[model samples]
Target chain A: MAGHKIDGTAIAKSIRERIHAQIKEAQKLNPRYKPCLKIVQIGERPDSSTYVRMKLKAAEEAGILCELVHLPSSITESELLLQIQNLNNDHSVHGILVQLPVPNHISEHTVTSAVAEEKDVDGFGTMNIGELAKRSGKPLFVPCTPKGVMVLLKESGVDLRGKNAVVLGRSDIVGSPVSYLLKNADATVTVCHSHTQNLSDFVRRADVVVAAIGKPGFVKGEWLKEGAVVIDVGTNYIPDTSKKSGQRLVGDVDFDSAIEVASQITPVPGGVGPMTVAMLLQNVVDATTAYFDKQKARHVVPLPLKQLSPVPSDIAISRCQHPKLITQAAGETGIAAHELVPFGRVSN
Target chain B: MAGHKIDGTAIAKSIRERIHAQIKEAQKLNPRYKPCLKIVQIGERPDSSTYVRMKLKAAEEAGILCELVHLPSSITESELLLQIQNLNNDHSVHGILVQLPVPNHISEHTVTSAVAEEKDVDGFGTMNIGELAKRSGKPLFVPCTPKGVMVLLKESGVDLRGKNAVVLGRSDIVGSPVSYLLKNADATVTVCHSHTQNLSDFVRRADVVVAAIGKPGFVKGEWLKEGAVVIDVGTNYIPDTSKKSGQRLVGDVDFDSAIEVASQITPVPGGVGPMTVAMLLQNVVDATTAYFDKQKARHVVPLPLKQLSPVPSDIAISRCQHPKLITQAAGETGIAAHELVPFGRVSN
Candidate 1:
């Protein structure tokens, strides 16, 4: 039986459309309101350039202001850090992302740590990852790929609670964070890595399998539990002379065989890729909304009062003061007019 | 078949003796070299007092300066925070520990985080635990209980590499950090909690099991794989009419039943309990040694030299300068004479 294919492209598109509409709606109330993302790219790596371009185009399509700050390969580590600090201090930029695979001369750890935690859209900093691992931690923003994987799982209607989840690979970016997310969702999570023995024995019993080992077709269909949900995060290139590029993108799971057993599965190229960009855009929107909400909440005005000459009884004092309407109070607290619900009139 | 009892009490005693000897050796060179621990205990909860006394006795026995600052239960959170800050700023206090169960009014999170990360001997702070969770993170100090568990595992001759290990808890204290440690050591780890289904199936295939769910005898011996190693961290008090106190301490695993099937097991009263105080004293010593090492490292003196009229070739310049003996150089670099091994005569 052919398993149901998870249409990641459609899901990602719908999410992007929702984000675009939300941004447009926010702009309608305040024309100046706009979510902004700044990407810091170093060197002229072809792959890095391609990813940056994809992000730029996606951000623009989602009504976000995206800017690329490309620097020369010869830039010193201190100079790179200064650039990130400037972006961090800029109130206009809601999200800051430092493209990975930085020049060998520059330390990736230092560069990633330089991004302010609040504006760290990539969420690769120690603070964010550390919080994600904590049992009751509240991270400001989860990493894009892991966050996207969670969305795909939810969209597929998989109830993670009490389910056995086996995560292959333990990369800080994908495997570790996703396992933490699965555990946080109440799934019994087993993290299998390069050193894991009897790896198939683990996958064979898992209710859900997330493969991110970066090896093409590393996970076989026979290893998966029948009707299991498979989300492959690997993006490996294998030789395919029939293709124009002479190579084709594949995931850790062999799709042909997995589709025969999995109840739901995501394809390689279009699966996790598009969702990453969508989640990045969503994080920017959320940060911008939070910024504006804080600004509006600060607009609360103190009510003026007439001082009485003599102190009155508590009942008399309460009767003397005039109370504002519930709607007026709601407005003062930054609640939108459309959000207010009136439950009967206040009695005198 | 009966399993070997992991005598944590004997292991802890040996470790404390080594620490005591090390401190005495250090004092031989510098009489003032002393590791100090300041434990801030809120209220007078009998259990808390008992634990504090155990820690104090263990620390003093290990040649550490232990001090207890007993605060009233009525103290506000801010006041408690102020006390922690004072301890944090005190260079003389190498380790600062705040006893748990502060008070109903005080926030435990706030109190735990208030202790400086450097002086956090208990290792309950977010920064320390966060570092522990990272792939290559070098935490200043790991939490005592988890650290003790690792020591017990090591003492039992359990090689974690490529092993299947099941952790039966997901707490910020024990289960979580130990799982991370095991994973870091290349063990395939599955973390099971209250929401886990088929928990016995997970434990049945494990090479090692660590139970810290606080439930007495929750893990059955039948669930254990033959010859599996068990590290029970539970300390539960059960009514025992045969005991003088009318109660007895038990672990998450039924020791009598577990021993019959397991290769090794830790008994509740003498197991993880004693190791906790031993690890705390070790952390205090480690912190004090680090403090002095940093001070000693900064004692390097600049060598003065005469300027040459004309720049010489590298070979010519090397022949003109006087060279100090290797021992002299080692001394300047804070290496003790006993630590140095002079290989030959340094080629004259």
Candidate 2:
């Protein structure tokens, strides 16, 4: 069977268009308000620069403000943290993303955690990752690559429910979060990494396969179940004597042979790469919308539940039993304590 | 071949003896110092009382102090939280655990999040969960049941690396954290829940199976692969006319048939249940050791690397290039700027 090549560039183009429309609508409502994303880059690695440039360019197309704070490689951990803190406090900055491979001197945790949870657009913060892993409340942001993979799957009209999805990686950024997202979508996900024994056996049973282990051509076509949908997230540079640069990009899956067996497949450079940038732009728009909504809600009193956890069904039912605690909790929301009466408990 | 019945009680006893030895050594050095675990229980469910009694008795036998704070069911969430905050501030309190099912009036997240991370013996806090998910660095405390499962595996002499592990369930306390721990130990981990399609198919291929779904006998004996090691985390109550109580506890797995195929299997009631309390006591001792060690370290100047991230190989090599930042990072650890000389850079 010949596979349908999923066009990530076209899908990303459509997503950016939606983001542009949303930004236009928000700015029309508030003349002074503009959605802004700040990219914090430490040291000038060629790869990092290229990725940052793509993000900035996409932001411009989406009509979102893009600001880059390029710090020297010599910057210390505290110094980079100070920069992140400055971005965190800036009300104009709706989304804050620190480009990966930040100078060797800076701890990734220190840099990421410094970002305000509300403004952590990259979704690299530990609490953000924790939120993603959690089965309940909505995550503030899903990391770009994983979010992109989800979007691609949706656009391809893949019904994830009851699907046997195998993910070949356990990385925090892509594999871990993506698997959680798939699980959240009701897909039966298996995460196989370097430690997996008989990895091919797991791959062969999958209805959907995601290769993101960063090893070029690690997944063979023989491992694919006939008509399985494949999403290759790995981006590795393999030596190519045919090219003047002496190297070419490849994915974790062997695309040439995979196309023959799979019903749907994504190519190396064109598949997941563009979708990642699109998702980043989408996050910026989302963060902007949330910021404006929060600002408007500030003028009016927020609901007591809004101030509490994201999913308050459990607490909402229990709130009826504690009249005094309910009044106090409601009082914080600027509501009249006496007016908020006990709704009576309803047990699940 | 008949399977070996795993002895969780014996393993836990051996672990408790080690904890006793450590506590005795610590007390000999400082007579006033004693490891203490304070459990805050709201409402007296018979099950909760039984579990708490077992934990308290075990702690006493291990020469550890265990205090139970029994609060009324009508107590407000804030009131319980205030009590927890008080314990958090108390230097004498080594570990603070709010017993599960803390009346419907309280949000578990609100109560658990209130426990100080350093003194969070249950390890349910978001940051603690984050540390557990993190690829590097040690988590201060792992949730007891998951930690217990890891101990059981190690004690059984099962090499986790390259094992095909299927975790049945995705609850925060057991399936989720345990999967992360298994992955960290280098086992290929697949987490299956109710949403999983053809659940039996995945279970039948697993080398190591962990059943955490709370349904009794949900995993049939026929579903297990031959010679698989089974860890049943489920303790479901089912009606049994033969029993005087009218109900008996059973695990998620059908032990009768599973034993015929599995190489090793843990029985219901005595398996995971005892190990959970054992790990809790172990955490108390560990927390106490950490507190004393931290106090001792404060008296002596800390090394620069100790103050930094666990892996700083990248930074160590780059230290020569950034002398000013190196001195500043080193300065905070009590080293003079001029005294700390860079040895030269070694590029990776």
Most accurate candidate by DockQ: 2
Per-residue alpha-carbon lDDT of model 2 for A1-348, expressed as tens digits?
Answer: 689999888888888898888778878888866889999888889989989999899899888889899988977675576577667756778999999866666777777878888888888887777767766635789999999999899999899988999999988788888888898888888889888878899999999999999999988888999999999999999999999999999999999999989999999888999999988888888898887676555233222332455556876756744233343355455443223443432111
Per-residue lDDT for B34 in model 2? 96
Report the lDDT tens digits of candidate 1 across residue range B1-348.
999999999999999999999999999988879999999999999989999999999988888999999999987776676678678767788899998877989888778877888788888777787678778677889899989999999999999999999999999889888888999989999999999988999999999999999999999989999999999999899999999999999999988889999999999989999999899999999988887876578454444344677987888877775565465577678764335555433212
Query: Could you give the C-alpha RMSD of every candidate to the true structure, in order shown?
Result: 12.6, 10.1
Q: In model 1, which runs have C-alpha deviations exceeding 4 angstroms? A: A29-32, A293-348, B28-32, B295-348
Considering only chain B, report the TM-score of each candidate against the true chain B. Answer: 0.85, 0.85
lDDT: worst 10-residue window of model 1 chain B? B339-348
lDDT of 1 by residue, A29-133 (tens): 999789999999998998799899999999999999999999999887766776786787677888999998888898887788778887889988777877788
* Docking quality class, candidate 2: incorrect
Name the TM-score of candidate 2.
0.84
